[model samples]
Each structure stands twice: as structure tokens, then as C-alpha cells.
Target: MLDQLRQIADGLGQTLAPFCEVVVHDLLEPDQAILAIHNSLSGRQVGDPATELGMARIADPDFTQVLANYANQFADGRQAKSTSIGIKDASGRYIAALCLNLDLTLFRGLQSAMNQFMRMDTEGPRESLDPAGGADAIRARIDAFAGRHATTPRALRTDERRALLSELRAAGLLDVRRAMETIAAHLGVSRASVYSYAR
Candidate 1:
């Protein structure tokens, strides 16, 4: 199982360009879930005793209330956003978990900036409307977005652009229809002008 996990992790690292790290944790023992299959961590591992217990007892009916979210969601802070999946055995028994931590600070930052814009009474030059924090804030959003979407850093075609936009919307970064309009406006066009691009 450990060997198979390693192969899966390695394949994930290859397939997902922004995937910076992959860690597989064995859930066989409740107390030793913290042990990494391959220990190459630089800082303190992210672990909460309560969270571990919550994951270990997933079969318990009450555990649902304890941890309602077991899927990916945007996290805020220096290290935010991870693609996490709970691994299960053939019999549908929980066995382990796989966490693929990707750099998404820019996407998260852009969402924050958008929120700030929505709150303001007016819209003007982006720089003029920027928060008092200035470039640091802007950089975070841009960095996160670029890192998360432009993994290859290659120029994206219209289809790629639309695909990425769709992903962002699904991730709750943008509204379904409004996001289309926003992208259209960015390209100096209308919503109809972008549909073909998406196709």
C-alpha cells in the first residue's frame, strides 16, 4: 500500500504542475496518523490532535457534525489551498489520505480584492482603489492566480482561458454568469463575444 501510494504521489507531482508537495498519511492507527510516508518536511507538520481524531472516527455518525467539510476549499494565510482526498480500500473502508498542496495565494488574493471592490462605493483606476496595504496585497493575489492556473507559464489559448475561468468560478472565486461578463470586459468586449472563445 505504501509503495502504491508513493507511485500515485509521484504521478500526481508529474501531472499537476503547480503541485509543490504530496504527502500520504496512513490511517491504520489513530495515534500515529502523523507519520509521513517519506519525511522531508522542513517545518512543523500541520496537525491538530482534535482534527486527527475527527478523521480517524469518520465511521462514527456524530463525526459528520465535527467535520462537515472533507473536500477542498480556499484557505487563507501564507500557506493556503490544498487538493485533499480521503483514500479508501476496495471494501470502501477508510485507509489513508492524500494531500496535494498547490500554490493558490494569487487566486485567493484576487478574490479578496474583488470583495474589497464590491464593498467600495465606486470604481476607478485599479491602483487608486487599492487598499492601504498597496503592492504587497496586489502581489499576493497575482502570485496566487498565476501559480495556480498558469502552471506551465505558457501562453494560454481561448479554450484554456475559459477552462481556467470555469474552474475559478466553480471554486467560488467568481459567479457563474458575472464571471463571463467580467472576463469579456477585461478583453474589451461583451458577454456574447466570449462564448465562442470558451468553445
Candidate 2:
């Protein structure tokens, strides 16, 4: 049974390799309970004494059979997430245990980087990505419309230009001063073409 447990531990360790350590403890041998250790993240050897939790399982059969995602750390103080499962014999005597400890440093680092990359600037660029109705807003809306088609404003087809102008006219964006020139310049068209499309 202990050998079978060791094989299972080795399989689990390989499956979660580089970041996780899988340890099997022979609860009956508290003095040297570690029957197998794989992935070796915790720097523990096979002959090491059982942990306090293992001792608890030995001292009390009623101890929790499974403790999952509990906070833990390595001797080097790196953070870890752990899950422990206790096995019992036919007579309900606690016999062995399997524990997996996953290092969280890499995950935490990735989380930190994502947070940094996604963080918006609170101190620079006085402009807003979503401004209220104005020339800036009109420009932002037009740019977005073009972006939806995976193209730039200046590259929109004549029919697309007419549709965009129609929308701007309905939205009263055309009422702004120099709106026609603005649209013409932004769309890389002549002012006469803007007037023609606005119809």
C-alpha cells in the first residue's frame, strides 16, 4: 500500500512539476514518516519526521481527512498553496497521507505584471477616452466606428463615409463649428465631398 502511494505521489508530482512538490507520509512512522518525496520544492527528504498535521492525524483518526488550498510557505519563505489528504486502514486507523504544495511566487508575479499593465494613468493625459458630446467626443466616436471595421477613418469607402456622415448628422455632431471641415480632414476627403455625403 505504501509503495502504491509512492507511485501515485510520483505521478502527481510529475503532472504538476517545477511548481509543485508532492509528499507521502507514512503516518504509522512518526519518527521517520516521509515515505516518498517528489518535486522536492520543500527540501524535505524521505526519512524526515512527520509534520504536526501528520502527527495530528496519527493521534486522532477523526482528524480532517482533507485540508485543501491552505496557506503555507517553504523554508526559503516563498508562499505556497497546499492540499493534504489522509488515508486510513481497514480498521479506520490513519495509515498514510498525500500532500501537494504549490509555489505561488510565479503566479503572484504574473498577477502583479497584469495589474501593472492594465492600470490606467491617473496623473497624465488630460484627455478622456470617453468624453461627453464635443469635437473630441465626435472624433473619438468616428475613430471607434472606423476601428470596428478594422480600418482607419481616412481609409473608409465612399458609401461608408456617407453612412458615417448620416449618423453624425442625426446625432447633431454636424452642428458644431467647422464640423464639415473637421470631417473632411479626418476622412481624407474634400469639403465638397463631405457636403455631398451629408445629404
Identify the candidate with maximal TM-score: 2
Backbone Cα, N, C clashes tallied per candidate: 6, 0
Off by over 4 Å in 2: 122-199
Q: Candidate 1 at residue 105, lDDT?
A: 58
TM-score, candidate 1, is: 0.37
lDDT of 2 by residue, 1-199 (tens): 8899999999999899989999999998899999999989989998999999999999999999999999999999999999999999999999999999999999999999999999987898776443233667578768988998789999998888888988898888998877877788788889999999988
Writing each residue's lDDT as its tens digit, candidate 1 over 95-182 gives 6666655555566788999998889545755544433333343234334654766543134455665665555546654443355555
lDDT, candidate 1, residue 124? 55
Give lDDT per model, in order.
0.51, 0.90
Ten residues in sequence with the least summed lDDT for candidate 2: 128-137
Off by over 4 Å in 1: 14-19, 34-58, 61-76, 106-199
